[model samples]
Target: MDERTVRKTISQLAYCYAVNRRVSDPVQFSIAGLTGKAEKIFNSYPSYSNWDVNVSNKNLDELWNPKQIVYLTADSNNLLETLNEDKVYIIGGLLDHNHHKVFEILVNFCQSLDWKKAFLNVIPKRKGIGEEILSEYKKGEEITTVLIMLSLSGASNQPPGTAFIWISSILAIIVDCLLIMTIGLELEKSLFSYQSLLNWPLVECIFSSLFAINFFISIWLCFNGKSFSDDRTSYSLAATFSLANFVQYTLNVIYHVRTWIAEQKSAMQVIDPRGVGVTSYGGP
Candidate 1:
């Protein structure tokens, strides 16, 4: 897994720990098969080293008895309906949209190892994933800004309209951040669940338009340049960041449209590899 995926996984594990600990009976978890980027994150983050958790670089088979290992795959007919404290269970990761590759390879690998197979009753949900990280990063940014604003007394040195630009940028950032969280939360909602005040598609459309417009406005503000050197630096950075957001936001809008089309046609399609097209490509 990439670093972000690893971090997200660790976060999920931490959330599970938090939830379990709050219950009358708690469970311990051992996260095995740590390697590469995942290992680095597990080691670096104190959160991953929870009270009842173990982290190891060794593979699951090496960490536990293979005879007791019940390697859980989604395709398994058997469902693990009950929880046993002593049973050794291994859960597979996300199912690829192209189903055959993961299924076949997983069966062969499990068969070769002769490990048991069963499906877990619980599946991971994407709704709250990455939420902790987003909150943390936002907190860090706000605290840093507070410190800087407290230390620097540049109100008089700033340009005439600098406060307006700053306020606009800050407001835009807050709105966009909330939009991102809302999108993640509603990712698993039913296709036509549009009764809510703000659905995912509507929020995406608003953010996409706002991001593009914000990019142009920031550009205009920077070039018009009534600002001092410090104020101009802020304007320049705002324009740069705005343009970057607009580029990525354009991709988000493309995906939103393609998903909408797929729903209408009742045919799910894999998105084109990046650099090929904006939407799904029927051809390889």
Candidate 2:
């Protein structure tokens, strides 16, 4: 059969598998025979003598053979060999594991040749089979992204922004130390209090932490944005943004937790509300 006819057959077989989610009898039988022949060729090679051939042969025999066994196996093998003689002998399996093995064999064959030459060789057949698979994959990606976006509606946008603020604050805090050093030289005392060493001004701390978190989050968002922009499917965009938003939201939650803890500590230090003579109820 001509290359076009062979590819058409493979496409029809692939379509059956795609729709049924399992290899049909014709495709399965063809693949089994092809696998057997490939095993024979592989075992015939002197380099693979150390490997067990019986096991492989038995496995190949067990697999189903498609009706167009001769055309599919022989043509695919020849095409792969013609494209890359060095790696053609390694090709094996047309239907196993979603045809991933066959695809890899094709890629290896393509990689052996120059890109233009490989493209010329594969483009025609790909027009028949590869394009169909790519179209399906793209469609699936779109649907998945849309679902993800819908699920992440409640996540806040502030976390990423706040993360950025926190990072900047950290840098500023370092600079502040230098300033304190200069002030200490002018006066005999340190610029900030002992308490400041452990806990700087809460506003600066909070804002700075937020800035740092937001900076990284913004970078992540930009990366995800670029990824989603390349494919305008709802599923892809939704998934990308959902992950980015979730990370940002998590950082914000952490920030809030820390703030809450600080508030609790501050509240504990306040004077008693009862207003009795009790000054500091807790023991020293």
Candidate 3:
């Protein structure tokens, strides 16, 4: 059928599910059991007010009992199942354009069903948040850029400097070792005792070794492969430097949340000039 026809049919089905008294007729078949709790909730807040019901009821008399269910053919099985469980069979098609809202309602309705009783099969339409995906991607990109900037400007600057220092320390250690060996050889031929041959050289070697180890570890962490990805690597690298940049990001997020919470709290705490914090305060 044409899109308009399908939409119209779906509207009719929604109406039947929502407001049509015809759909209230209790069916005999029970495939899946419905829980008493679900029944109570359904009874409390009937689905007759749903927009789907209004739209559907406008077009057809028998909302759920259409001669042929045309719109949302794929979801027919699940819909039937749900209806049978509720002991209320729907004949009209389900509104598909505003499917996200419809799915939520369906979920709530299903939750109210009694699990003790099984009913006929019903199919539900799939919903998507395609529009939100692009927004999320943009948000991530903005955060990554901010992180990169903070890393370059703040104490996180040590990442690059630390790398250079690490290399220099290694070279210094090598040179000190060679000097110690040469000095020891020279003293062996002279009046100087072996212990005195390279007294200062030994001390220098010990200090150089310590600096070398520390610098090497820093470089290892700086170049670790974890932050090399095309998408988030830049931000991850910033996180690795000085640890302060990482802390900054965490604090920034916390600050935003706190600000929001404070605003909410302040709004809640607002009182009239009489010092009474009540909802009855006059207009601003």
Candidate 4:
């Protein structure tokens, strides 16, 4: 990539890396278009040194086997249905409005240029951030098409980050279960005593309401994961939310049943043995 282009997109790259780091699978980046002068300038950036950034002067044909190289373009008609294994996807390192189009056309159409057949058979991507040949995109922009390509091609897999998320999700479920149990116990206590019917403290009511709202929201987000994206991370997040909700809802139902039983017992105790008079119990 050109030094200027890399400078402008380095922050975007970092953002994408940050987002992908928390997820299951992340894409790797390599700089392949750097010339001798550009390479010297690129080495000055500290950001490039932090990650596994590869720099190469050789083009795709020289760097990779022709069979293992797939050019991803917005101009081609060949749609990528799936990702090929052990293949290096060649995306334009420079963000340009098809500035290479003239060269591509001259190569394909005219015999004047020294064109090789290696540049043929490009795959077209139907969707992207916005344009077909985007040299630049907005901040925090997600590369959905690339993700899909990786997933389809089998390049996508659950990395350590994904496993970490799974662990966190499990922990969240455990904490939620404990909260549900606490609520259940409180419900049982209130069933026997008339205290549950009394006005609750504003702070306590607010906390409980907030928790309930959070639970419901978690459920909604998990179920709607597909509406956001079809990535594995989204699916896992949805699964975690669903499992947690199931546990919470089931425990809540059990708590209600226990409360009903407690209420029945209290009513029986207040009734007189002779069945002639009713005794009033002390309020909780």
User: What's model 3's TM-score?
Assistant: 0.21
Query: Highest TM-score among the candidates is held by which one?
Result: 1
lDDT of 2 by residue, 32-69 (tens): 33233444544454644542222333433254233312
Provide TM-scores for the models.
0.32, 0.23, 0.21, 0.31
Evaluate model 4: give its TM-score.
0.31
How does model 4 fare in lDDT? 0.47
With candidate 1 superimposed using the best TM-score fit, by how many Å does residue 49's alpha carbon deviate from the native?
Answer: 3.5
lDDT of 1 at 21: 60
- Clashes per candidate, residues 3 or more apart or on different chains: 0, 37, 38, 2
- Backbone clashes in candidate 1 total 0
In model 2, what lDDT does residue 193 have?
A: 28
lDDT of 4 by residue, 148-168 (tens): 212221122222233443455
Task: Give the distance in Å from residue 81's predicted Cα in candidate 1 to where it truly belongs.
Answer: 3.6
